[model samples]
Target: SLFRGQDWLQLNLEELQQSTTISGLLLELVATRDIREGEEILLDYGSAWETAWDRHLKAWTKSPGMYTPAHVMDQVASKLRTDEEQKEYPYADNLQTSCFYEYEQDTATADGAASSSKKKKREVTTIPWEMSRTIFDWKNLRPCSILQRSDSHHHQGGHLYTVRIRNRPGLAPNSRIPRGEMHLVSKVPRQAIRFTDKIYTTDQHLPQAFRYPIGIPDDIFPEAW
Candidate 1:
């Protein structure tokens, strides 16, 4: 978890479930607004710790010296990306060349505006979940800029943009190569959107890029989804 005191953005689990990742849990950390090119992304880590403690920590601690294996964590992160799921996530189609979301007019009126006034507003055709996932999963992913605060109460928000080659390929099926970064900028009020459980379950596909070779369990958290 990227903890940034109270100044950090909220981790939207529902949103995270939309993207293809190597973890059973895909955490979508959204920016409150259009962050600048070089702003830092701060998050409230204590909140997540509190939630994990309430839900899983107590049970996790009972096992003597038992901790989540790194390989297991990596496998969970590298799940498959299916075609059916792409129908729900348009941004998944954008992974071929770039994973950035672009707003384009589907239709226009005689006045060179949207045919319907209600449709004139900028529509995010897709959320670049791949970009967000990379930022969170990649070991070598360096933010364009970072800022540190001596005190937690002093809030400092941030943003970033980067174009980099994949350090590890085949992390997920049909994963983007030479992936680029994109931000979910908003001008209107934020939507209360969340990802469903169906969107984040494990896939049957075998591991492709074996960076951390770990044995797959027969019953690998079958109930997690």
Candidate 2:
């Protein structure tokens, strides 16, 4: 269904008149030249379609353990009992254990200071799922310098922080930074201790309109893609 070499057939659109029994439109694939026996039919779908397909092929990547049997995966998954064990396993690369934290703020007194019993209690929980690794190492990450403000109650004071991945050894001098090399600078409060992931049920917590699957069939995909 792609124009591999020179296209052997061309597309033609024919419109029928109102007086005819068949009054709609018909699309015909006419042969461009003489064809040999048992040759595959190829159509030139135009430049736009070809460009889009080329882009998709360039961006596509094979999923982890795509060709492996389900029984083999079940056998491998049964042995992994701990989170550390699962993280080190090669087959469980897609599976990541994310921790969730709950922060409880202490009550403020009439003197405009936090009470003496300002105990910060955190509830830690781990949830594992199939998530692609964005940052290879989280230990090397550090927050940027915070800008000081005279007015402490100001909304914009000391909120924004730029975080970067450290110790990138193989980068050449003066090369443009890759898109995945940097994390998004966000305006988060200094008091906020940790980030957590929330699980949403399909078509319930997540809207049905945004629940469409994204992928293309394997047959038409190019080998060099």
Kindly list the per-residue Cα lDDT of model 1 for residues 15-131, writing each as its tens digit. 445645444433444566898998887644455455654565344333332233323433342222223443664322112211222222321111322222344334322122132
> Residues 1-225, candidate 2, lDDT per residue (tens digit)?
433321212222232122333333233355778899999886555566677677766765554332333234434432222323334543332222221111112211122322224333522111111123432244322222222212334333433222221123343343223333322222223322122122332122322222223343554443432
Which residue ranges in model 1 land beyond 4 Å of their true spot? 1-156, 165-167, 178-225
Model 2 residue 164 distance off true place after TM-score fit, in angstroms: 56
TM-score list, all predictions: 0.14, 0.19
Error of 1 at 107 (Å): 22
Candidate 2 Cα errors over 4 Å, as ranges: 1-25, 63-225
lDDT of 1: 0.29
lDDT of each: 0.29, 0.31
